[model samples]
Target: MFKILIIEDDLKMREIILENIHRWGFDGLYVKDFNQVFNEFINYEPHLILLDINLPSYDGFYWCGKIREVSKVPIIFISSRNSNMDIVMAINMGGDDFVQKPFSLEVLMAKINALLRRTYDYMSTEANVIEHRNLILNLKDSTVSYNDKKVELTKNEFKILYVLMKDKGSIISRDSIMRSLWEDENFVDDNTLTVNINRLRKKLEDLDIENYIQTKKGQGYIII
Candidate 1:
């Protein structure tokens, strides 16, 4: 089943959209914190997104730009304002389609299914390979390894390690890690990050890497 993400601010609208998603036997996630939309997006890993224009803290345009930086997921604009400027901006901002307010739910789902089929049905796959230090990240399967031994991790652990390894020698704050894993089933908190990191450290120790991850008090973490 295709997973859909709703990035609307209106609680009622989000609720109705989610209902349609369930009716179609698909997984759907609603964004609760506008400030951390990207984190939620990655964790949910939706096939497509329904993004509204006006939002708290920042507009949908800002968030759309951020998502584009990391993913090529399909986006549809659901806005009340049908101004020419709005439609132009939505298309220019990477939206696959725009649905004016008061749109029929049936039409919305049709657009969604059509987009998903077009994007994923015959799309080429990209490998997810990342390397740093003695660690190699296998993007294809979300696996990590040092030398010839593989490191098995929970989903959160893999994400934490991936982010850290991607920026090796740079300090990554707890807040940053939280953002990367926030879309996970269990909302990631600061303490949860610490626990996951420690677990990863223990696993690494078995492979002869002692204290590989450096901790900076009141700042962040780094793998030196």
Candidate 2:
């Protein structure tokens, strides 16, 4: 079953859309925390997204750009705004399609099905990228890029970053990080882990990103 994430803020409209989506035989998911939309996107891994323009904190356009930094998942903008500029901006900002508000559910579902078929039919694989605070980590290449400048990471550095960034808001313990390195056959002791972390921090600082990783005394490390 393909999962569809609905990012609409209107209570009635969001519920209606979700009900219709389930009626059409697709798994429907909605965002409970608007501030954590990106995090929910990562957790849900939806096949497609239905996004609204006006939202609580940052608008849909900002979230769309953030998601585009990581994945090419199909996005369809749903809004009451019908100006040509709005539609143009939606597409320009990486949205696959647009649906004006007070639209027929049938039309919306039709567009959804068409986009799903067009996008997933020919695409074989998805890019493995993680983005936080405008910093992008490309897992395939073991490199980190910030503000257009890129830096290569050693195997240990890449693994450590990956583990932390994968769970960005949570603190990862020293022992847990060592186990991750051990699983990768890196054989890292406490001192070695500390050395790798310092090196990674230096590289991030070189990219003008200070305090990208934070140390929590008596606990562990976290990227926030």
Candidate 3:
């Protein structure tokens, strides 16, 4: 099933949209951390995003630009403001489409389905790769390549790199990585994550990529 992320702040609207999304046979994800919108997007890896222009911390445009920097995930701007400039700005900010607020569920679903069809149908088989600064991580082969040099990654290393690159501009905590590695962080070894990270870094260094991953000193790691 395709995952659809709802970044709407209005509680009632979010719930309604989520309910309809599930009813339409799509996996729906809602954000719990408003400040970590990109992190949630990376973790969920949604096929499409439904973003609201008016948000609590940062507006949808800012988050849209952040997501565009990492992935080409489809984004639809949903907002009450429907001026010509708002619509234009949404499209210019890498949004695929715009849906005005107080919209009918049927209309929204139609737009989403059409967008998804157009997006996935024309995509190539190799399009599953996630890229960051010329470093390509192939989702199909589980390999990372940079400048004609490639390295294979362990399952844990791939997961760590995927999460880090997904939230490139933000710090991802060790606790979060632990939770991603295991269902419960408490069961994970304290040094296991550190060891995996070091191995991943070494592999990258082999490709002449140095300090790509930055340590935030007690915070966690970030790709910058």
Candidate 4:
């Protein structure tokens, strides 16, 4: 089932949209921490988003632009602000649709279904980048970016970072990481892996992102 993320701050409206989302057979996810809206969007990797214009900390437009930088996932703006400018800005900010407040649940569901169909029928839903903290690793270009500075990665560096970031908090053994590289046809032993790890760390350090990949002593590595 397609997952829909609800970014509304109003509890009552959020609950209503979430309930109707599930009722229509789509998986519904929601944000409780308004400050972590962008983080939640990365973590959930939802197929589509229902975002409210007014929110605490930052408004929907800010978050929408941030998300647009990483993925083209469909976003629908739901807000009480029905101004022509608000609607136009929503579209300009990468929102796929705009639904004013007090919208019909049936109409909203229809729009959601149509957008999902049109978006995914001929396209892949997998995100091309993985984000942790403020770091974004672009799988398409084998590049790691922090702040606005980007560093190109070698095939080995990209593979290693991809393995660790894909399972951010988990302790991946050296054997496991080496096996992942092996699967990609880049065979390497323990010493070679260590060199690659140090090189990757140095690149991250250049970006001022220190200690991003932590060594777990007896264990292999982890990104937390």
Candidates' TM-scores? 0.55, 0.54, 0.55, 0.55
lDDT of 4 by residue, 1-224 (tens): 68999999899889988998886557999999999998999999999999999999999999999999999999999999999999999999999999998899877876887787778851145488989999999978999999989999998899899889988999988977875555322356999899999999999999999999999999889998
How far is 36's C-alpha from truth in model 2 (Å)?
0.5
lDDT of 1 by residue, 1-224 (tens): 57999999999999999997886667999999998899999899998999999999999988888899889999999999899999999889888999999899867876776687678842136346777666777765766678878877788888788778767888987876775665412356778888999998898877677787889999889887
Give the per-residue lDDT of model 2 (tens digit) for 110-220: 788778877774213635788999999997888999997999999889989988998899998887777556531234699999999999999999899999999999788
TM-score of 2: 0.54
User: How many clashes in each candidate?
Assistant: 1, 0, 0, 0
* Global lDDT scores for all candidate models: 0.82, 0.89, 0.87, 0.88
Q: Look at candidate 3 and give me any clashing residue pairs.
A: none
What's the CA error at residue 29 for candidate 4, in Å?
A: 0.9
Model 4 has a clash total of 0
Q: Which stretches of candidate 2 lie over 4 Å from their true place?
A: 122-224
The TM-score that candidate 1 achieves is: 0.55
Per-residue error for 53 in candidate 4, Å, reads 0.4
Ranking by lDDT: 2, 4, 3, 1
Query: Distance (Å) between predicted and true CA of 5, model 1?
Result: 0.7
- Candidate 1 vs 4: which has more lDDT: 4
lDDT of 3 by residue, 22-47 (tens): 87668998886799999999889999
Assess candidate 1 and give its lDDT. 0.82
